[model samples]
Target: MTQQDIRKVRQEERVAELCAGVVRAFSGERDLHFRGRRLHRGRMPLPWFAPHLHPSPETDDFESFRGVADGLALRIAGSDATLHRTLQPEEPVERMLFEMLEQFRAEALVPEAMAGMRRNLRHRHEQWSLAFHHSGLTETARGLLLYAVAQICRARVSGEQVVEETEDMLEATRFALAPRIGHALGGLRRDRFDQAAYAVHALAIARTVATMLHEAGGDDEAPDARQNDTDDKRSVFSLVAEMDREIVEQHVSAQSGRSRLLEEAGAAYRVFTTEYDREHEAATLVRRELLAELRERLDRRIAAQGVNLARLARELRALLAVPERDGWDGGQEEGRIDGRRLARLVASPAERRLFRVEREEPLADCVVSFLIDCSGSMKEHAESVAMLVDVLARALEQAGVASEVLGFTTGAWNGGRAQRDWLRAGRPAHPGRLNERCHLVFKAAGTPWRRARAPMAALLRPELFREGIDGEAVDWACTRLRARSEERKLLLVISDGSPMDSATHLANDPHYLDHHLREVLARQEQQRDIAIAGIGVGLDLSPYYSHSHVLDLAASTGNAIFREVIGLMAGRHRH
Candidate 1:
């Protein structure tokens, strides 16, 4: 690489490291990797862990990342051990109440954990309230009420009155919805703000409003309303559009006004678009007999390294063992005598040499997946990747870990809108490429490595190799991995270099595919159970994979590949 390129790579890595550090602070997780500006807490309901709050560009500052972290921590804690379960109300009023209480609860919990969080939380509440002040949506009304209740709770807990308007608004809402408010108030003691009681009160008010709306219409009205339902639908769409505009404005207003170095880098790896039209055709299952023949051939190649494979299996089996074990409390067995407890043994002669250390075999609870880049550039390397995958799969299976081998590449080259016209007009001079994207599934995690032999051998076919799209492939691999019931999962990508798809790259910016790959890796790494690493073929993949190894299969041959593959998987298995 040139000096300028080297410097650029270092700068990108440094920024990415900084972003990861920010995520670790908020998530209480250390092993997370970075992709663009998006942080990941894998296995979360909200998968992407960005610095800013959702739909708010104003909160996109580095400082706001901390607030998001605090919120995430509160959420995790709430999910784990909170006194109240998240309510599920079927009624609109009940739903509103449930939502308000949940929001109030989150704000209340933040201050208890972090003192400084109170100021930020209050500022955020004020921002939301102001932004939605003129929004006429029922959801916004529920949100405003939530803010009012939160202010009251804050005053009670901190012994300081906040803005008087909040108090005024709460009193007004309470009086306006008195009967409904009474149901909620009846549950609370006159003294303090009880979380459940306030939640009940909000639900009652919602129920009352819903009843009023319902009572306003009848059977005759239903038939008449259906007659003009199309008009009503148009009005609903118009309302939705207005709400969307308000949300967009809120995001724009909150947008950070600082340097966007991190954002720029993240943009480099973003998934601009996704194509799924070619999946069914791209993932062609190999014929049974052909698959069997290929597996037999690979088996012979794998059998050549019987000694090394056996040793690896033994080491892995031992490494995957449980950390602790227990022995018989009192029994006659072949074991070491408890010399330190000799006095006790002397008092109880029958207990002599009774204690023994017991060992339990570890469960084979691991899944390994190989994602190969099948772009045309990787044709020569595909054979090597296939061999490596077969050998690794056999070894892992022998070691009792589940394994799958998959491949990703695009179906068409340089096929876009311009190419579409040429093909539709009878392929005059140039035609659009057929089938835009392709993702191959050589083997599934649940399938035995032996059963996947033919499909694995299909990797040798040059015709199938096209343009590679790494991000979507990684995502697809992760989706499959997530379905497995393994405690530990490992995804290894074998690629020539960074993600490249001419159809996409030319259509948008050059770095789009690369950014998406980084994002996919970031998300997969956040999943505590899943570990992702890469083995680049004749190229360095370090820019994308945190744990990556560069290997030249042309020079290394069988033993070298086997050794490196074992080394990579061993590190994962041990941990």
Candidate 2:
């Protein structure tokens, strides 16, 4: 035998030793656990002491665990075969960790170059994983991220080496392939893969793992293939998992625990208000007494009894003084409100203080009725309807202008009956609480303007009066406002440009409510001081602009109707 044979035999022995190390590390056995490192498993990775330090599985050949472990293990196996001259281990885990590091060499794989790549890549991978695990990501997320880091070892699958993509890549790749694979298989059972059933596991490993990885930000950014692999131009999702994990550590969890709620990267922002109204309800022990006091004050404000104008004004002033928060800046957009250039806020001035007090009004005094169109035509614009109703309710509440909301819709198909009516008036505790109540208001008997006008007669023309310009919202507004108060009465009518069946509900149509609808419209041409506004939600409800008709009609696009509703209703000292 020659020196070549001796060297070949030595290399094989080294390979076996390296394989042994990987198997041990994965198994949670001795001489393998990295200091400060732990293997996480199950639904969410949580802390537990080292796997009870018990008897372990015997060391089968290095390839014995073949295909049983994921890519991390595969990379671990490949890296184990190239240590010593290839790389040096700083710890039990780093020895195995370098398997991936050596593979994605920054440059050519000349002997020295190959060796340096092993050291640098392993260091980067391990360091990254350590910091990531240190962050608050759940163990399940950590486990997936760690697994992806391990797979970095085999990023370049040279010459027919079996390599599974990182979990995120696998997930996205499987997505790209599963449909095609299914299409190709044409309904034959998804079974039989060279002697193993991997269809379910393969897809699970890719999609689910990738989602976990991407969510964790280990990343979804797909890397460019390292020379031998078939994949090119990595998907944004490839690094998405690692990216998620990294970003969480870098951007999110770095925040104090108070701010950590926003730490999750790429988190879906369903609700994003910085309010903690229910903080104490979640945990009994209180951390900040001020938070509790603030909460109590809020509850009082919501179900606020005996409207304290001075106290409320002071509260508003304090809130504005913070400068960190955002809210109504009567000082900023100073347009003429009620014939005066709007009163801008002036801190510490009696006039300003008095004015703020004046604006903080009584709920009963600031009454408004949002009469919305709920007829068939409203279905095409349900989104608009939702917006207007939401906006109106919120605006009224915000302005200290307590308002009741009522929707109407009379269906022609049902022998001229109201198909829906939703009406409710109560102090809403929060913005979302307002939204929930808005949903309930539309559950009653109601209809659109033309048809819904039929019910208005019941509220307006009760006694010797028969017909003519009698409707609920307008009549209610005028009659309610008649009480000698300085507060203006508001009637918000949201409808399409059309009027319904009421104009002809007369004797020739005696079967109807013995009142002429057209006569009623003519009578509306002579009202006063009833603050009227018409909001057309995604429709042309633009027949307003006079004392008789609503004087204001704003075309609110998208969900702006609600914001506009608040803007329209926010008290401007209407007399």
Candidate 3:
């Protein structure tokens, strides 16, 4: 074979090596920390390591910077003699130290100042932009230029067409690092202001440029194709009463009596007018109904799976507790484990306190009570609410917190029988998501607005037996706990707006809770620094925690709710 083919093979081999290194770094098989690896006199241990660079043993920090050096070497030498020109051990290290911090202010007292940081890393970049006509690399342009070179080197290493799983893995690392880099720079920028902003902006620019280059080189896979758009509001379609474009004719009945199938398909992709809004367009009306019918059939099939609230919660907890010994793949003991498990592990509340992800303060023990609403109006949302409450309980449990759970509903609303006994006596036959076996299995439909305060009974009274009656305990807990002094008082109320407030305020003109609630709650807030996350499961929260920080799911649904819960509570509540 000729030299060109030989060169390509060599590049692929180099890429393979780089990928193994990156995977090691990603998996924490390598020293993910880069504090001592800085090539400068003193570079602060910044977490903003560039992801575009391939992993290398020659450097401990900033593989992206090394990638730049290698890329420059490759570009300068071409396919011939490129190996000899590769970065020396100390050069890329020095370069990373220089370029990454070259733009920050140098004075310690000044904003985000480091020992010899550049004054607005953008100054040279702005100058470089001005001199786009003439060219000699500037300091600001060095990071940008080196990164482009690194990407080119990456392209050479990872070939076209065939499987580049390793290459994709490396690229994925970079993509994942973008937002992190943004955050790092964001922190420094806030401290230093001008220079930090420029430095961060430059970093973002480098990432974007590298991504575009990688895509253009045909190393990345093509995205899924979709129908094209025909609704050019700029076009006189509505004004002229018709779109005489050939696409319209191709979609309509031509002389051959074959209407254009493309027009109907366009609406499906939201490219052209949606069938739902195409009232005036007769051409789209039939296609719209056809799509609607298809949607209806699919909806019916999915509805069973759609509201698997119980199952979803259980699966999430199981997934969260995926044992370290079982590994990732359910079937495998080993062999390149995958999926967002590590990410989940990192984002887990348990991980936060144990690993000291955000604090050194030791968490104190406290009793947590979960209050559930089992009224009729919340029947549609009951399973979901149970799942959410269960998720939090499991999260707290995993974080080593003791919790007491209770469900409450009134006897007056459900044939004079309390929903609490119905829920308390039952256990779900199957494993539903989170703690669905608790209250989700019961189907006691009563108005949510009833005295559905039975769930709040445990904390209210110490001696009262919870025989499914609401309020007896909650009132007791509030009264008895009033005199006791604890370092932290933690109370979590999970409900779907079903309190005996109307009777308390209207019937008895309840002077007890209404007048004293603000004072009691205010004191509780100071003692606990209360974090009340009210999740109105199905519908709205206007009647519920509209006055507090609610994980309002009024317009959201299933997996989205689960995912957001994971995201929101990931590191929260950890000392």
Candidate 4:
């Protein structure tokens, strides 16, 4: 078999095994087996294994399957008491009514078995109702009746409101069909899954419906009319089959129209983000040779400022140093003496011993990860940002603080997956945005800043500038920090402006990326105690960061910017 086919088989087996376990736990059924992943077939709670339904693209497959298993468990458990037998009916109408009622029973019983299935089942019924409404089968009398029944069932299960026409139809049909409906519902409510009982109810309901149609048509004919006698002659099975087909076709067409509408909703600018990994062999290694020239220039500039970052490093070291504790000696310290000293004193009156004073000093273990934006917007301030990173990284190294410097942009210019698909559709190109996410590791934690200079100098290349995916970049940085052994972790972001991915906004809502960034940050805060700070090169980043600093690169030199960053880092410790 092909490798992909083998993988598919393994996946199916795994899913089946998982489902079997769930069935055993919930319903105690052992005969159940998984047939295949056929999404259209939907959930089947038959005695034997039928092709298991797959979840929709947007739904969680495992959770949906768990609910399905719960529904099946209800059936399997009910069968134990009722001793269900397969009931085969000759008429399509009988089969359709039987299956519909059975479905309704399962839906009602599912919530009792699994509380989470309540919402999922409601959504399923609602979607089924909608699919039927848009199926273009409302012209047929049987279709109208089926639609009305669906609405009523949905209302019964979900407590949803039915329309006046639905109520009127139910009222008209209730006189003849209510007994059969009530009997089947009653049996199902008691957790019985006898197909024979359901078959009798289905036959009764079908005959009543046939009779009702006959009387309405003023035709005095037997209920078992020929297939060509009336529209109701079509079996319930065929009717539902046709309805399902129509629904699928209509839904596909509707989706195509919606896609076009989404394409038109955004501005002329399209932005997108594709994840790119630069790490294969040495992803985090920033080549020292590449950054040597830039490093020398930045070092000279910093030295001219007379701020002495090395001095600050020394002070930081002192701040983080821990005091050594001394053991007990012959000193007059007002504390309890060692046991040995007391024993000696008891033996000899001249014995003199002193208590030990234990002392603990905080370790200066800190890890800082710098995330820089290399989007086109940051081209003007890239040089200075690079300079700031070089000085800060060097000072951090001198102070024995572990640090990393990373840069993020995009790989393609309006050429990401989203844009490719958009173009394939013959749609006009949207201007103003970068597509594809390309991450460059200028330096890795534990790697000295001097060795990473060459890779850091890569920032001077304008071609590396594409777009910014700030949220994902921040998440990536946080993930790296979470792996470090340092007690204090800080993520410093150098950005030119807010996260702007043009294609992402055009394909979705404009605030999609913004909301995602917010959620990522919120999640990090809740999960980890990492310090995050943002320094905007020439923009206000307050909306994106709780602790943000804005700096105008035009008005400030590299030294000034570095000091500002140092101050910001120090402020994080301020009470």
Q: Best lDDT goes to which candidate?
A: 4
Task: Give me the runs in candidate 4 sitting further than 4 Å from their true place.
Answer: 1-290, 315-356, 416-418, 425-434, 553-563, 570-575
- Global fold similarity of model 4 (TM-score): 0.45
Backbone clashes, each candidate: 10, 53, 23, 12
Segments in model 1 whose C-alpha atoms lie over 4 Å from true places: 1-307, 319-353, 416-435, 557-559, 570-575
Per-residue lDDT, model 4, residue 426, is 65
lDDT string for model 4 (1-575, tens) is 23343343334334545665665666544444433221111123243211112233222355555555555555555433232225534554544554555555454555455567676554444444544555555445555666665555445543546654335655654554456465543443343244456445545545555454434433333457534544544543344566434423422110111123233545332333233334321222335554466556656655655556767677556544445444434444456666555666667777555454454544567888899988888887777777677677877788778889988876666547656756676655432233566777878997887677666677666677877777778988898898998888889889866676667657555565565565567677666589887775644354455555655555554355555667677653110
Instruction: Give each model a TM-score.
Output: 0.47, 0.24, 0.25, 0.45
CA lDDT scores, all candidates in order: 0.55, 0.31, 0.31, 0.56
Error of 2 at 43 (Å): 70
**lDDT tens readout by residue for model 3, 3-61:** 34334323332333343343334233332222112111111222222221222222223
Model 2's TM-score against the true structure: 0.24
lDDT of 3 at 180: 40
lDDT of 2 at 538: 28
* Descending-TM-score candidate ranking: 1, 4, 3, 2
Runs with alpha carbons beyond 4 Å of true place in candidate 2: 1-365, 411-486, 502-525, 538-560, 566-575
Better of 1 and 4 by TM-score: 1
